[model samples]
Target chain A: MRTDAAPSLAAPWRKRRTTHYRRAEAITGVLMASPWIIGFLVFVVGPMIYSLYLSMTRWDLFTPPRWIGLENYQQLLFNDPTFFQSLKITTIYAFVGVPLQVALGLVLATLLNQKIRFLSFFRSVYYLPSVIGGISVAIMFRWIFGTQFGLINSALRVIGIEGPSWLGDPNWVIVSFILMSLWGSGSSMLINLGALQNIPTELYEAADVDGAGTLAKFFRITIPMMTPVIFFNMVIGIIHALQEFVLPFVMTGGGPADASLFLVLYLYRNAFQFFQMGYASAIAWLLFFYILVLTLLIVRSSRAWVYYEGAIRGR
Target chain B: MTTLPANRSFNQSSGQLKQFLIYAVLITGAVVVAIPFAWTLSTSLKTPQQVFTFPPVWIPDPIAWWNYPEALSSQPFGRWFLNSLVIVLVSTFGTVASCSMVAFAFARLRWPGRDLCFLILLGTMMLPDQVTIIPTFILFRELGWVNTFLPLIVPAFFARNAFYVFLLRQFFMTIPLEMDDAARLDGASHFQVYLHIILPMSKPALAVAALMFAQFKWNEFLGPLIFLNRSELYTVALGLRTFVGQEYGTDWHLMMAANIVFMIPLILIFFFAQKYFIQGVVISGVKG
Candidate 1:
């Protein structure tokens, strides 16, 4: 991927000409990167600063923002019960949903990794729902999880068992979200499959030579080899879990006493529905801070578990 | 390398059992994943009465295909479809054009501050959209760009998504630099090399980016929900939301019909360009 040959435009005087050529390349690089650089400033950095300011104040769209000096944050942290409820719901959803997605995704990937006929067909079927947008899936699942005539209840009734209202019951609302999360485990499954395929056969052969059984070979070889990919999935999946919005919004509307009210859902309500832009900004920042802290914790924990093939020296 | 005949036979029997078990689990998983689509399709064709029928009609008795026209006509879905098409196509074009260019810079060109800039871009990916939504909305509102598609479309032109840029950059890095050397020897400028050589040769990666952008824009709910207030300007996703949010009695059959209609384009794209979708997911996952 490296370019070693100097273009003809570079003169024979190696010192001065090399400097000139380097400058030209640098200018081109900056020109090429300018779009993203400018975009990062305007879209990401600028709004981030303004949001920090907005988080400190109380403002509706019509009036000028009144500076509240951390009142929004203080109120949210110490005074608001709904804020704590939203946090509790979102925390449970993310912590539970992420691990479930990772584990189920790995299981599905392992099943698919077996040498089989119609491999692509099976993979496609599993991965299909993930490509579909969140809104449509949420709507479809709303019907599937409905109280009286939903698919699950109807099926449960045939087996002479009763089923609880999935979306309508507060106790079962998070369970419904977890089930939905499992349905879209395709991305992690694909990643795990790719990692599984890339594991060298020699490792398994060595394990076979040692009279290692399937379970032993799996734990000693396959899992250790797959830790890097697993770590990647966990981090990405946790962030995604924390940011869930559309599904709860479309399916349950955070109903059954706000049991499914994810952090982002609460933020949306504050910003748009309630027109509490400043307080909404505070919630957004809190969510951002939470995600950052969680990501750092995962990265720190990965050092103990995640293995790098190239970097490892010995058992 | 030789094994006893009895040992080989024993291994073969065990392998057969393992294969059967794998098939069992895979089939169960496939069926579980697929049932929702099957149910949605069946419900789309069912009458209101059959939708709630106990013992669950897997197939609608009368096959009420009229639900499609009925649901679609009840809303200005035609207008919404057109609106969605405009937003998706233009935004996809912007994403491909800008992200590819930015990716080319990051992947191929040498510059001071380049690594720092790329790191900053990666950091932005970790920042949730909620952090910026309020201020970005206010920015657009102040520009009087509310109730318009500009808020959604213009950001793509600026290469707003770092993930796309990273994906394109990863793909770009795999292209051998000898090709660029030949173009450079021919007196091609950096832009010329990007335009004439890289873009033409990297069709698959570009297709991945464009398809991803199109899918994302078509199904986008939050942006459209916030910005576009007029029903006439509603994207298909927003239109479907309105259909489901009607105040009167919920019409399950028609709502399912509309959802199936909304999903048609995505399904078609999946059937035709399935490999790109899978490849994109694999690539995005591998390095991250």
Candidate 2:
């Protein structure tokens, strides 16, 4: 991950004083990067330690802290039904939503890469919703998914099919979320488009001469080449989905029997709304460990499927 | 690709048919993307009765351009717009300046443990803000920053976003190292080189970072939702959320109208600086 500037010591005389001046340069580097270093220490590292401390105690805001070690974790892990509910909700969202979005993105990218007309236009329109995300989009979707008068329901009516109140139904809230997510699938589509450009035409030509059909070439060559980028998108997608907050928070408010109660939304509720700061902190640490373990496992398993062009060539 | 050896005419015909089929599918997908926004625009112009009717009114019989004014005037949206503007501008500027400086250090300057530090920085990119949300909320509350914009804006100056720094570093690395060496030889200090040389070359990357940062903060929900409790201090995003609630979900016309108005600036930015926008997404993807 660290790519340093090359050691371009042009002047021979400077080489001798390199040790002394190099230390000087290091000091300058630290100085230049002091903002981030300082920021890290304060915002990230400091708060992380505080979060761990707070997780073990019972301290609601406007009250003095009471020493209650392991209580919050025990309550969250062992007793709380909603904690398990939210975890299941979050896991289901991530597992289902990540692949669908990544696949949608790749499919969109594949089609758009075919030297199509209005290429940028397609990409832009598809990507527009993601940029305009949050409360505005939530409001728009609220109208679009309204119980009796929604756009989707109207369209469904036209086709002689009755549409459920997309956001109103507990059984359909996650499906509603997954549908809303696809509107913003352009982000990874654009990523895959960029990755697809890097795949040389010669590889396709070689496959063509071997009498590979379009589907065959896609499976054998195109997919294998795109797996690294796909994996990248999956990691980001899964993480983002696992921590999904704004849409569900604003749109569903984790309502309709907490069917859409996402983990972070539950955490936010505990911290801010319910004033269970200690419990919320415990939830935070649980999610942190959960994501860390999931990420590590995915990365470890990636060795079997993720193909690096450079690594493959080296072998 | 060059033409295959056999059935050249048949290949050409199928190719055309294949392209036609692809367009058929793509346009259908594009329609799916367009429908919600299109519906928003359409609904914004409809009368309140028109919005809730079965076999919904596709377009308003009479255009209700007054809804835009009504939406803007009915709420404290005017003030909310100013708050959002202030937040986005401050967040964007802070992000561009801080991330670029830190990126210069990571990319151009040689230091012991620089790589390790950079990795630590990248590690933060994946660390969910949720993990630290509670403690940070408390920290900000302790600072008396809860009702203010400080919680949202102050962190930007402190390099809160690791992705921006990583992005700018990727761009900074592409600038040849000799320029830094050349400046160093002329007795230009690292700060001088960063400010005078590296920054000048990094305008595009910085602009991309700024745009993405602006969009991200403009759409930000959790930070402001958690920190800013007062309706008077609410940004437009928060305003829109409350706007939906105030009517108890009855006023779709004004709500959609306001949503469109809020979307206009970002849509305009998309049309104007799409190259940078696309570049931002591509760089974030391809690099990391």
**In lDDT terms, which candidate is top?**
1
**Best candidate (score: TM-score):** 2
TM-score of chain A of each: 0.93, 0.94
Off by over 4 Å in 1: A1-17, A313-315, B1-8, B245-248
Candidate 1: which pairs clash? Answer: none
Q: Which consecutive 10 residues in model 2 chain A have the weakest lDDT in total?
A: A1-10
- Cα lDDT tens digits, model 1, B1-288, are 123224777878877777888898899999999999999999999998888788889989899999999999999989999999999999999999999999998888878887678778888878899889999999999999999999999999999988899898888878877788789879998889999999998999999999988998898999999999999999999888875652126788899899999999998998899989888988887756
Candidate 2 Cα RMSD (Å): 2.4
- Across residues A94-151, which tens digit of lDDT does each residue of candidate 2 receive? 9888899999999889889988889988989878877796677788887788766777
Off by over 4 Å in 2: A1-17, A313-315, B1-6, B246-249
What is model 2's DockQ versus the real complex? 0.63
Q: What is the C-alpha lDDT profile of model 2 across B120-207, one tens digit per residue?
A: 9989999999999888888898889989999999989988899999999989878877787788889998899999999998889998
lDDT of 1 by residue, A211-297 (tens): 776667767887898888888888888888898999999887888799989899999999999999999999999999999999999
Q: Which ten residues in a row have the lowest lDDT in candidate 2 chain B?
A: B241-250
lDDT on C-alpha atoms for all candidate structures: 0.87, 0.86
* TM-score of model 2 (first chain only): 0.94
DockQ for every model, please: 0.57, 0.63
